[model samples]
Target: MNQRPDEDFEEDELELYEHHRILVDKGQSPVRIDKFLTEKVANATRNKVQQAIDSGTILVNGQPTKANYKIKASDEIKVLMEKPPRDTEVISENIPLDIVYEDPHLLIVNKPPGMVVHPAHGNWTGTLVNGLVYHFQHLPEMKGNVGRPGLVHRIDKDTSGLLVVAKTEEAMTPLAAQFFHHTIDRTYLALVWGEPEQDSGTIVGHVGRSAKDRKVMDVFPDGSQGKHAVTHWKVVRRLRYVTLVQCNLETGRTHQIRAHMRFLGHPLFNDAMYGGDKIRKGTQFAKYKAFVQNCFDLMPRQALHAMSLGFIHPVTKEKIYFEAPLPEDFSSVLDKWDNYVKHE
Candidate 1:
């Protein structure tokens, strides 16, 4: 897919205008029983033109009308323009990236919080995708597409952490295959409210789309599109009201850590979407409600970080590992928690 098109073939693929704007010339009275188009558009089949007129795409005197509307002499007419050859090319910019490791076949990056992994409706630019495209101008195809460039795995927008990107097709396939086989080592450090009774454990359940809200995921009672998601969490540190846990993903799913942790009664702190208002009291109970509130107010995103990543380097065929320390915001929260506990 990354193969460049032949020069002649590429030149032949030209963008063409869809519609034309024309004014009703003087003494040109409108008369349309059916099937008529202003001299601005082509490929307007009789049936489609009628449908367009019915839908009010055709306008006369700045007002939409059906196909039968008669045009008056010297009246203004505007046809909705259409265009062929949509822009499919992605532009690359030399945005600075936190490159943990880079080689001919792969690149590892510690993606910051709030950096979206891919382009979407509101985030077409300034994404990891855009950054990668810029960094590797001629990055080989991955997953049979050039748009993503080399995206082999993805973390949530707010989850800051190490991610391995394939630079070549050979690297992309193996990395992707490992992820499918659950061989890719991915771990997250999360500040979850409430301490689990157990020291370390696994949370396993079928995760599927939530029935109540399509935007969220829910644990399925009877498994549907729900796939088995597993997370092994070990308590790293216990705060006054929150516990820092290291979560290892056995099977990656949408919001797997967040949903599973929330299901296990330890939703990540300050996760307004899933943690709910009930978790607010923990911050309040710290005797620094105002301070905690201020800190939370200052925080830009979730309290989860991709702290550890281990994988086999595709080109060198050597094992590689990387880790990203918790960002300052999360660290500050922990520091405050420690201070409050010490005083108590």
Candidate 2:
């Protein structure tokens, strides 16, 4: 089955438009451009293709083409379309932010757990974007990007960590490019159930939304599904039943670390969505169970944090790095684990 056109595309964080490039097959017969695109582009209807052509967003060989234009073998096609607008308007909220680093071009913020990065279906207010709009007037919004104003990328609402925000378009572009090219250096710290067989290793798999549950991600080791993803991880500490690991991302995908860890038989501790809420290791003693429950209570959410980020300054053309200390809950849980292991 064909995937959505955007599914495999590498979109920049700040891009407001969808850009698609398709190369005609050599054995293809001449066909109407709109008809060809309608068949080639997943979920695209003829009417929508015609509308795109009418708006001159469809180009053949670098020039805008008509709907009725005949597509020849090896013809290069490009489609650019503005993203659809959201139904709800983004209202700026006076939510406080934890600024890590700031400059004229960009700023790094340590987002607390449970705060949405942008307004979405269930999260319509009190998001980081809403606060950003309130704190800074006229922050550069990507053209056609409705709700998000300055975000180049984002972390999950339940995941606490560092995120970089672009203050200007000049800053947004290069930063976005860095993410698209996998040049941004991001390291996450996660406490996961069970110790990995190896002290350090690289996990290579395709990560995509689960077929059974669209809400969460899954790893496709066969490469028959999903986008290519790579995660490098090394054990930082062994907590007997659980392990503290540092993960470095080579390709960013939704829940890449969580999904890959789950695939490795070591789901992140307390990650309910990936089945880490239950005890995956250790003894079945009532005391041990109670102790594990206390650890979960200490940090109810996934034991994951975006601890460090490094990249070339979009404006300065210089490399810079920033790190955020583990949040109180995460730290407290680690302490509990240490004490438990020591006594055992």
Candidate 3:
């Protein structure tokens, strides 16, 4: 059986549109276009294909066709859907944004730890995308991707950092391609429980959603499952119980740094999903536990920050780099650790 063409598409990057062009083989049997498309497209159902047909987004020989139309040999079939069907509309909110840089093609914003990058299942309002929509007119939305508009890349909600938004459609493709090719330079600073044995090393493994918990990621050491992920890490500073590590990502999978570090037995401090919320190191005494608890209170989220990002300009081909300083919560936690280490 032929593999679905979209199966080869990268999921980590932004996309402009959902477009599929197929040339019917000479030996292909006569089948309804909706049925054919449902089988040909990944994650496509017959109902969805019918919806596309009804919406006149599916064309045959450059003409919109009905769902029951039978595909013929040597037929040119094209499916062009501007955006996926969204159950909820993204309402523009007049929320403030900390835009670091802006141009005709793109803009860089420093997102705070709690703000959701885009609207999702539970977060439908007050997202960064909602703010972008209100701040900028006509921001481009990713094709087949709903909720996130004008965004080329996103940082996790609890991970404070820089994110690049493509203002124009022309800028989205190249920026997305840079991420897909692993040419974008991204560095994250994380405070992890326990120091790594080595000063610097690379962690290579396949990363995917965990089987036990679908919300979190798990590393596959043998590369039997998930996407290939690589994180080069070096110790920045060593506290008594935790270490500050700088991580450079070679591949940007979901929760790559958090999962990889957890696999290395040093999950990010206060990363609840990866089991870093509790004290992983230090004495088990009541005093030590209270100190750790206080530190967690200072920074309620994961101790991970996207410190820097570098990428080539989509139009000018010039290289650009941006950095975001650690947020107050993360900084306060670090200060507490520093003081504890100094007095100890």
What TM-score quantifies how close candidate 2 is to the native fold? 0.77
Off by over 4 Å in 2: 1-88
TM-score of 3: 0.76
> Which candidate tops lDDT?
2
Q: Estimate the TM-score for candidate 1.
A: 0.72
lDDT of 2 by residue, 191-296 (tens): 9999888999999999876745545778999898888999999999999999999999898887888899999999999999999999999998999999999988
Task: Name the runs in model 1 displaced over 4 angstroms.
Answer: 1-88, 144-146, 221-225, 276-287
Can you give the TM-score per candidate against the true fold?
0.72, 0.77, 0.76
Q: What's every prediction's RMSD, in angstroms? A: 10.5, 10.9, 11.3
Tens-place lDDT digits, model 3, residues 150-176? 876777778888888999999987887
Candidate 3 residue 80 C-alpha distance from true site, Å? 26
Which is the winner by lDDT between candidate 1 and candidate 2?
2
lDDT of all predictions, in order shown?
A: 0.70, 0.84, 0.83
lDDT of 2: 0.84
